[model samples]
Target: QMATETRTHGDYTVGWICASSIERRAAMAMLDELHEPLPTPEYDRNIYTLGSIGKHNVVIACPPMGTAAPYIISMTNIFRAINFSLLVGVGSGIPPDVRLGDVVVGTLEGHNPKEMMLNPLVEAENSVHVETWAATPPQPLLEALKKIKTEYELSGSRIPEYLERLKRDSPALASRYLKSDSLQDLLFDADYGHVTPDFANLSFIPREENDCRFCDKTMTVKRKPREMRVHYGLIASADREIKSAPLRDRLCRNFGGKVLCIDMDIARIKILFPSHYPCLVVRGICDYADSHKNMEWRDHAAIMAAAYAKDLLHEQDLQILEWLTPVDYGPRHRDFLRRWQPETGLWLLDSAEYKTWLSTKKQTLFCPGDIGSGKTILTSAVINDVKTRFQINPVVGIAYIYCDHRHKETQQIDELIASILKQLTQKLFSLPDCIRQMYEKHKYGQTRPSLNEILGVLHTIIGEYSRVFIIVDALDECPTSSGCRQTFLKELSNLQNQFGVNCFATSRLDPDIIAQFRTNSISLEIRENAKDVQLYVKRYMEQLPAFTELDQWQQETMLVKVLEHVDKRYDLA
Candidate 1:
């Protein structure tokens, strides 16, 4: 262990320890870009090194890309398995019997056969051999397969691919790629598999090598009596990396008789040197042909083919989501504020107090303002203010209080709760991963959120998403019992004091509602803020294109006249 040398890299140092690997070489290449290769010791004949990733140093060491050595070991969250900063098992598929052409879409069981009965050629070959080697997939794996299939079914028709989209917009990719009937067929899920753009090079495997008895019989691999194409999981190894599509798939299909991903020796590496090592696979679609026969797919072509493959199958589903990330797209909450273009926090309402009240982050306030006072417009402004000021990017949200004047009591409370839930969901439309994970943990959306649950969601938004803001218009119109109103107000006060989220309410100033808030919660009268009202009215008029032509004096004069003229008698509402 002492014989090994070490050197400084960022905060950490690079050195060679006893542990060694093919992946070590690839990792070194990447690490080397920052600096020269540093050597250390062969503690257990292992490869170890320390290099700076940024300011901090990373101790990266791997056995190899293709050997039966652990492909990776990462203690930190930020990891890269050769461009797969994130790798997930979308799931697996069977092979051979299931001719998996590039871009082909099928269910888990589509590649599996319930029974297997081969011709006489296989019958004479080895009944005992088939019985011994034929695969009976694990029931759990099968069940997972079924679930994936069901998910696909629920998704309905696929979204159009970039190629189809480009054709509509420019007609250029269509002209070039659409030339081939095989290519033209790639428009949608035209077939089981969307042929990858790249052609496969089957030269690596001897054409005769694919011959079989009961199934594809290379040497060790014995296919089931009834064959189906399925992508099997396997490990890979390399002195560096075996990125060649033909090589990877060929070795996997020919040698291991399994589906191929990036890391060639993960299974072997795990077995030989066990650890929760990460491995990544990124394959280009070189060919879709079942036979060794070749077509137009080549290296660059294969790259495109793979790109298209993801587009057709996985990427299509992810396209909508791509814009969802905060990185790719700016915060939607901010976007809403920018779009609304509110000048100040006040939402236009008959009562000045309620107008200012709307600024609260979360509340189901009753708007006591007179009718036609622009309550809805004012409420929208309140929500917009929170969104802009706090820079809260809500993933789910909506802004409104639906009122069925037809039924204000029992039906109204239920409706109010439902309405709030809907808006909350919109603000949380794209729930934070933590919130989503937690919600999924508790089965939230599956059931209406309890008051506590709703509060919890607000907390999550405050924690993970951003500052919470809610605008509920005209709760007074809701015909629920005074107690129900009190409960709702109580919850709001609790939320406000607890989470610092504000709620703004507009109502007709019902004495019962007022008494409820005063007794059970911190209540504020909303009818009297005349200055804020005047400002809002003026601001609203100022937005008119012609307002720019008017001088400041004219603006004030117009606002005062409108404010004084509008009927504010409490008896009318």
Candidate 2:
């Protein structure tokens, strides 16, 4: 009974998801036999069209218009029952070579699937795979495409016959396609856009017919042969429409000229499918994805995409479903200090000695104080000051680490080094070749670097930047079980002494830790800056209504008492 149920659910061989109603209708028109709409669960909002195309049982679906999240949810729920998926839709073309009616088929490239599965805009330990999350079409689909191209070359294209069949089934779709004008398929130079005061305004307003102000023939680019063609390359998928030619060109170039078109929804679906579940995008070229996008060719483009999908599906044999188990790269961890770093409240910013050290050639500056002397706050202020001073210099990189006793697992020496390295590489926007090579070597396996291996990567990364500022706060809190603290300090000393990386660290004055920095480091005592504490205390107390209600003499007495208690604590340390 279980085997029969599994076989019934696995009968769906192809899944088709479209972005618009026109694309969905075009896809439905290609079906050989149609069935009644299958009942779905309440949570499943997708309106699925069940049918057979050629010898394959295909499921066609579309989400509510103008959103992508529901499409993702719908596809994921249906993907388990199907063997393969196709994101068939209309996308904007990157112009000059790609024309208005051209079809773009996405090809796969190697990508870190773990990074692509997560939201790219959110913060994560590993960098997001923004431009590299595409995979080539599977081997079977590529062979079918080649056969289709060869057939089209031998005989006339099948698109005309497909259009006739579609006309008989739904005249409305055929009428829309017939009304699509080829004269509106004009390619303009990248530098010339709609003549507006600012090109950033994206709202579309109704205009009278023949009122286009920027339709000068001088700005139009003429193509030699305006024939429809199939282009195989990277098809970028994003949640929003790309509207600038400069940005489109930049993305195309960044993807190494393999990106031929841009779509609103496809890449996200591709990344979430099972690794063995073959997927491809068949999209018609609607517009140039620039500022001048109009709805002149959308219907015609959708028809072209559906026609191409039918040609690819016709006469294909049923495939046996073989599930390939995907490799799981573990979750990426982040060492984020910006949210937890101490506030810079009336301290460190006014320190003349620290300012002098920052402006000069000092390689290391140590701020030692008792546990409650606001060392973390001081370190945070120094970080802010350095960032402000170096705001204009693109070559300077700044990173900080805050050690906590509560999180014992992260306090190890290797974790500390990895956190620091992650911060620096993220800030610099490019990793050193040495670190990249090391990562590539260990990427396939679960083996992480030893302490020595991490140190070697750090040493090489430090040489790539002109200057790097690293701040380590609460070093005394680092675990001391296996000489972790000593090893961490020794590595810092080496970075300062050998590589000239400017290191700023704050800790309680332990003789062992201080001794490590005594020879080449400049130490500043927080107790010496009593004025900063006084100012901080006064400002903090002024905000309290009860303290404000006290008499002047009472305020002074309370202030003195607070300072004396703090001083005694420092003495104990």
Tell me the spans in candidate 2 whose CA falls farther than 4 Å from its real position.
1-10, 69-80, 109-132, 136-139, 196-214, 274-276, 315-573
Q: Candidate 1's C-alpha lDDT?
A: 0.37
Q: How many backbone overlaps does candidate 1 show?
A: 89
RMSD of each: 19.0, 22.1
- Summing lDDT over every window of 10 consecutive residues in candidate 1, give the lowest-scoring window: 126-135
The CA lDDT of each predicted structure is 0.37, 0.65
Tens digit per residue, CA lDDT, model 1, 214-333: 222232234233211223333233323332233334444443353332322223333443232222232223332222223333222322222322222232222222222112111333
Q: What's the TM-score of every candidate structure?
A: 0.32, 0.47
Candidate 2 lDDT by residue in tens digits, 1-573 = 001122233567788878778888878777766765555677777767777665566788888654544665665565566666777889899877788888887765442422222222224333223343454556777778776676566434556556665675678868876434443677777777766433324356443222235556588787786578887666777555666676667666666666678886764565455445466788899889776777777778887888788777762421110001011111110112232233333445556767666765536788788767667655656666786686435456666777778876867888777777665553332234565566556657846667788788777777767788888888889899898988888787778777667888888988877887787777777654566556656666778999999999999999888777765321111
